[model samples]
Target: MKTNINNLNQKSIAVDEFFNNALFDKKKGYYSTKNPFGKKGDFVTAPNISDIFSEIIGIWIISTWEKLGKPKKINLVELGPGDGSMAKILVRTFKRFPKFYSSAYFFLYEKSDLLIKIQKKKIKIESNKVFWIKDFKKIKNGPVIFFGNEFFDAIPIKQFQVQKGHYLEKFFRKSKYEIKEFYKKAKNSDEKKLRSFNSLKGLNFIEYPELGFQELDKIIKKILLLSGGILLIDYGYLQSQNLNTLQSIRKHKKNDILKNIYKADITYLVNFNLLSEFFFRNNLKVKKVVTQKFFLEKMGIVERAKILKKNMNKLQVNNLERRLHRLLDRKMMGDLFKVIFAFKSNNDDILGFD
Candidate 1:
């Protein structure tokens, strides 16, 4: 996890190392080369599925700002903004609230230049309003809100297997014929980290997001310096299942994790319980984790959909309903996805969590 090395020329590389290369290698990474959103792409996200979803999130941001006493200057950083579609919709949604829109500065925190280019193309409206930052150092005056949709899941994860009271970390080694799996003794530091988390107890297989936590360390520093929060909405579990959830998506279908290289999207499910522990361990307060359905319903997505349906034709209405089902039905993304908020503020009333 310490190295950015992606090439398999080495004898072996940690799981996170290889996974990071799959999604972020400068020349051959999946995100560095393509726009993996929408029907033609591997899979679609909630924001792309419906404008109502973005609108609801926008409203939540505004409410959150209000709870922070409506700061004259505020920053909203959308972490790893995919194709900038959500931020694009957010720009339009913010405009409706002139006070928030004028004071708000949108920062799409993306590392991929190719994805940034695609985001810039989609968010051409009010070019000045949207800015891209590789990090969060320049905005010194305002409280910042760090938000990510399906963001943490994409961050590379380190896999470990328990072996007779010892830990063996998983790695990928490349041969002339193909890439293969191997294991090495776990580092002492990683073992110490695992011991600190109660959620990880009694697990034979572990998918620890060491790299993702490193990224969050940066975000956590900003939240502590400023006064706002970090809200993450992603598909994950509240409890650790003690199973390896790593998988790939290609052409809207599941693909072998080792076969596709950088041609497919690679990810592991986020563990909310572990994340909650992480925030608390960092001295930040965590709102109780809630399902995406509960959060959106509290934020009024259903009501927003009703309002939009009044103006649409039958076919359009059906499509809208289908999108809502995907987003809110318990049988679909509703129960499968979760929302978590961590902050350094006194106001405990985090919108949509109550």
Candidate 2:
């Protein structure tokens, strides 16, 4: 069953169909055609916000490298490295530790050829030390240090809502305009689990268990086989609960998620509780789960801000302070974002705060 919206009056398409077409289209997916980033793009990530963000992450990665015994051949893997800003910062910082830099092999798991070009231009790691792959499975075994910032939210999610005492899966149908609703009753046990999770009266929840588990399983299996760790940073909650977090952003402003299917950035808040549970169930050693604010504060963001401010004028200092607050303030991204870590080695305590 395909819904054709080519003749529809509405400019927007259904979210699911839109993503399917935009990302998986055999001929012309958006990713196949363009680079999405910066002020003109749909949204900005932490690495784009400031070098400080990636520098801190680099520091943590270096510490983790030491904990992993500074393996001679370690894979420093990043998923969805936007514009390569984080990778650039990481490589620059890693250079300070020549031993680690010499041993590390940078592996980027990215899909967009356009963005990969941008990343190549932005990051200047040794050509021999860096490589790119579309899938994680292709990478051979090694001590791995994985980083995924705001990557999970972008993976397509199955939105659902409980109604009339039954769990209904949402689908989009194209007509005059793209229409969306609980299109059908879920039949599979997985769907049943989602329905049960959403059954609480007056509660609405969205689940991405399939995407979440698949990624987790892939990384966990690799980490289990080879000693390594994963650091995940994203906006989310510590516990799974009923709430609507699907949102769209364009030109740094919030926009209706359902209004422009392929033209804007689409994301949903991650359920860290489920992620934590996943690692635990997989028998991987859980390192830490904490808010980004707390993690940054623990990593000395305040002191770093002070040092940066010392070199700037009053106006520059004020701007730096605001940016710091925006990233760490509870009223802003502070409470909205979270950090989680899972490690194969059980001895070392993670450097980031919990």
Candidate 3:
């Protein structure tokens, strides 16, 4: 069954609720209605930019599995696997390591039904090896490795601002004339929760992942019980900055967020520092956060690219070089994107962090 985010007829809803309906309403929502990947779509992901990116992730998975003592039945879940581009390559890359491939069960934890259909079409494997799920209740097993590229940012979040010792939460009230943003008195509980987090201190503006945390709460429970980790790579900041990063992008161009409600991709930057704080609070060990460039270089993406270039023609080599630069260049995804891993284990030797 599809995750219902239907707040359509309702006159007013919270910022996160509006995002949920706009991006994932199961009908006419951006993700539900169209494919938002590649040149034809709103924007392209790293996997579509280059397969080597996914290959690097595939390599990381194997190495991490080894660190986990090679569990007999390891569960690898890709959170919010967009377009299934990365997961498709991961499944193929795993085939080379036959032992690991057979031992691993691939799970795509997705919410968008349209994307799920697209993913199923792209990953045409006829085996019990792969599955799609909305929750973690089914995976009652040895260990679970949950990873996602550009996942958490897509989850809806609540935004707030502090004014003259008064706390107010942002909401989008869809009135008959037009849709506009207005601030309402925030809940006392929300204010208290914000104050409780040390990572969110001294900020006039706040973007709290209210629903996002609820989602992670489930995953955190699974990790504590199963002894595995979650690796997330997304565009976010490690420093505590009071900037509103909420954005709407379509065809690689930014539009006023409220302008294109259910037509454009809505997303915000993930706060790595906040994530670290939350993970620690949940009793999970977090690896040192690193840039995409740092993580990929440590994972040997440069070396992998060199090996691929040798077998390619001049044109192919040039294309490969460009793609590699995009992935590693500080001006592009290299510096803007960040990598973080949180696991419930004594082994902090996971690759791509140090």
Candidate 4:
């Protein structure tokens, strides 16, 4: 199951293929090899920064379920749940609503065997309520409150650049000189979309997440049938700015993505505009996208911090405060990360949107 990417001895792969191998080749993928979270890891996520993030999410879930008349069976799905930090926090919070907790079945969509082991260890207390899956298709029916935090960005992407009258895709090469070069012409809908976007005037490069869109499409189809909702929180652009946000992280620092290959965490910024459009066209209602700062504020992060502070000593309070600012400061994740909600029903007033 642990396939070495280098063993394939392939070259000039598509950008998607490169990323797919680098981040999720099953045996040697980034997630499979190590625990990439917290201070000890390459990068820390919002949940790792503080429990407030998951607390807010937990509040949203409970409130949304209440608005939906509290379904007897609900699928609480989390995609790419790294380290199981968010699930642990959210599960603990959900327990406050005994009836709701009893009605919920926890499902995690994770493929990395190594990370799955870590997740299993972290959520051992809730092991009976949890289930690991590679596909969401198995969640037959009923309402599903899906959570995808920093999920879309890690999926493979196809990079395209405009030249003359056509769009050329950026592909890799095994040759030393052209190992990281773009020299192929894109076709089909990739060409079509590039042309259409170009007709609007002034566009050069674009990274398309075909697989990401496909995944979203599948999830939406199920959401429509089940009458549930999805909440996605990640660093991305509200508009398609034609900038390549793809980058690599190693040991908590940015590295040249072309050189690092499978050694680092590779990611791109999610395009909220593109996703919102898809949700809208599918007849799903999209909530106003809110920054992490605004979302946390609306969810009472400040109040939660105050209550927690009352129980902490000076040193503990200081550490907690720093974590809070890291999560909410405009200079930090607050402005860069946004929260998006798309749902099947318009009746339930989702919280943390205002």
Candidate 5:
């Protein structure tokens, strides 16, 4: 379903707008079309990679709930919960902490109905307690400990390139056959950051997470209202810089972004620097960004693995070991994926940050 741009009376649109359409256009969006996860799909996530990932996250959730005074009823929300593997594992693990498990309600926010069906099949343990939210309004105001793994990166990003000391916004042209760049002056409050980066020579490229920032702002408000915290894990740079991280993945292999719109998963690296600044400016408590390896290690992944290996067979142990290595390998997800935490107050020290 190719959108007719001229029919909408538009010759060109900003990069983020184009990306939003290609990924969430209802009829032709990548997520709207089919399941895009696992070995058969475009790529696999940490949760799908191994249950150990979610076990540690489950521990983090329990720790956060305890820190939040263990509210009788807490809303445990997961944004972009693909296939619900994480949620399923989390519920199973929560059974160990009966107080937290019984007090928790699962709220999932997913845009695709097809994937939602798959999530339903995978998530059967807490089916009675699970609620699918169409919008943030449906989530009741309570202690909300939210998790967003690789969620922010999927949000559309606007690309800007510096040319001869002038910033040009990248835009896709439907009138023509190629992408176009237009010289547009900065109009946002964050223009000061641009001025600071002006001294860098050569072709400087930067991505602005305007939509991601807006979504996070809304999420922060929800968490703040409930006096709760958020754990966001994704592959990105801890410090912002002039570079392009837009990438395309098809069947677990990286491909050209321009290959086919809405056919492959198109995403950009998240800017934790901007996200941390947003949280701080809003008076939310921000934790020091840590690598996934550091965060998982702090959450006791190595210890957990040791305990599980005692009961597993030889092949099971080997597979488990491989998944663990992939998760902590410095050359793989370990150094690349970063974790950041934000909360409403600084009362209790957040786990996995130290």
Candidate 6:
């Protein structure tokens, strides 16, 4: 179905326009205004789902911190910390290791002003120990441990479709109020890559978040400069050649991505393979890439769940089992979501993947 643009203001915008206006316009954007989360948000994240998720990550972080020589001042950086639930759990978990907690500095790179406020309320961090910045560039150089959960997918991506051996961009014409896919001669490199993909047939569309890649490159450089490491967890394929992964969610239900504009969450699957290549080219060592099931299972998610369920009633135990299964089920988020770790130092194998 086509979008009804006639009823919108003459300057009515598309999702990309709204995002660009909000993020880059300097004058107006949702990030500059308020927090969007919980039941009122476009979608939910793993941290919002259960404390178990963060508990596992907390263990991972502490293990990694130990490997990093237990630095006196480590930068604990989280990108797009939604509502700070994970951060709150992480800090609480780290408190068990008093030395680590005392030596670490927490930093959140977030764009949503509203979410930042909510995060402040949710996480009780000392003003001198915790910081929030709108961009990663503001982060100071140090021994860094970075985390990005379902972050890259939310970044805006440019969409393209192959037509008669040519590539065309998908654009939203404000006047037309309809999504339009038009073609032009593809760039030599882009055309070469397109030709390499024999699986794309008929009216096939592909989205490449060049901006996301660029941002990743910058972050990687920063991490390398600081002699740091990063852990990225998201739902994406390892290959670059694929069809459109663009999708939307509203009230936990999938919706046409082009339907509601900014009213819903818009995202596409991440390409971890491309991301790995980007990091490898920058001389960063890829420690490992594995499915969430394998990672969490190695991290003893089952054991952890059992411990949490030991005191619960039959119904509670059943619910906990279901949630654990859902989290680790191959057909669900387990296989779809991948975990990749890249480090500057050649330490032993990571806990979850080892």
Candidate 1 runs further than 4 Å off: 1-10
lDDT minimum window of 10 residues, candidate 2: 1-10
Best-to-worst ranking by lDDT: 3, 1, 4, 5, 2, 6
Candidate 1, residues 1-354: lDDT per residue as tens digits? 444434566658888988888899888889999999999999999988988888898999999999998999999999989987788889888999999998998889998999988988888877677788997886676898999999999999999998777888998887876888888999999988887789999888999999899999999988899879999999999988788899899999999999878899998899999999999999899999999999999999988888988999999999999999999999999998999999988888878998
Q: Give the whole-model CA lDDT for all candidates, comma-separated.
A: 0.89, 0.74, 0.90, 0.83, 0.82, 0.72
Report how far off residue 173 is in candidate 1 (Å).
Answer: 1.6
Candidate 2, backbone clash total:
0
Model 5, which residues run further than 4 Å from truth? 1-10, 126-128, 163-165, 174-204
Cα deviation at 267, candidate 5, in Å, is 1.0
The TM-score between candidate 1 and the true structure equals: 0.96
Q: Which TM-score value belongs to model 2?
A: 0.88
Q: Give the per-residue lDDT of model 5 (tens digit) for 1-354.
A: 243323334656677877787788777888889788888988989998999999999999998888877789888889889888898898889899988878988889887887788898988864678888867786666788878898889988888887677676776664356544464665455455555442322446878787887787778888777778788999998666778788989888897776677788989887788778778877788999999999999999999999999999999999999999999999989989999988885465878989
* TM per prediction: 0.96, 0.88, 0.96, 0.93, 0.91, 0.85
Candidate 3, poorest ten consecutive residues by summed lDDT:
1-10
Clashing pairs in 6: 22-29, 34-114, 35-114, 35-115
Angstrom error of the Cα, residue 322, model 6: value is 2.3
Count of clashing residue pairs in every prediction = 0, 0, 0, 2, 0, 4
lDDT of 6 by residue, 1-354 (tens): 123333333434343444444343333433444344555665667787678888899888888888877778788888889789899998888889899888888888876766788889988867887889766665675588888888887777766777655676554544354644334454677656545433333435676666677677777877888877888899988766646787777666897765654455667787777667667767888866789888888888888988988889999988877777777899988999999888798675567775
TM-score of 3: 0.96
Q: Write the per-residue lDDT of candidate 2 for residues 1-354, one digit (tens) a residue.
A: 153334234443334555455443444554556566766776677887778888888888888887777778789899888689899988898889999888888898886787788889987766888888876765586788788898887776666666666666666554544454435665577455554432232445555546656777788888888878788999888767777677777677897765654556767788887777677778887766888999988888888888888889999988877778778989888889999898788656668755
lDDT by residue for model 3 (1-354), tens: 122324433656788887787888766788899899999999998999999999999999999999999888999999988899998999989999999988999999999898899999999885699999999987898899999998899999999998887889987765675776889999999999998999888888999998889989999999999999999999999997899999999989998887777789999999999999999999999999999999999999999989998899999999999999999999999999999999987777898887
- In candidate 3, position 79 carries an lDDT of 95
Evaluation by lDDT, superior candidate among 3 and 4: 3
lDDT of 6 at 304: 91
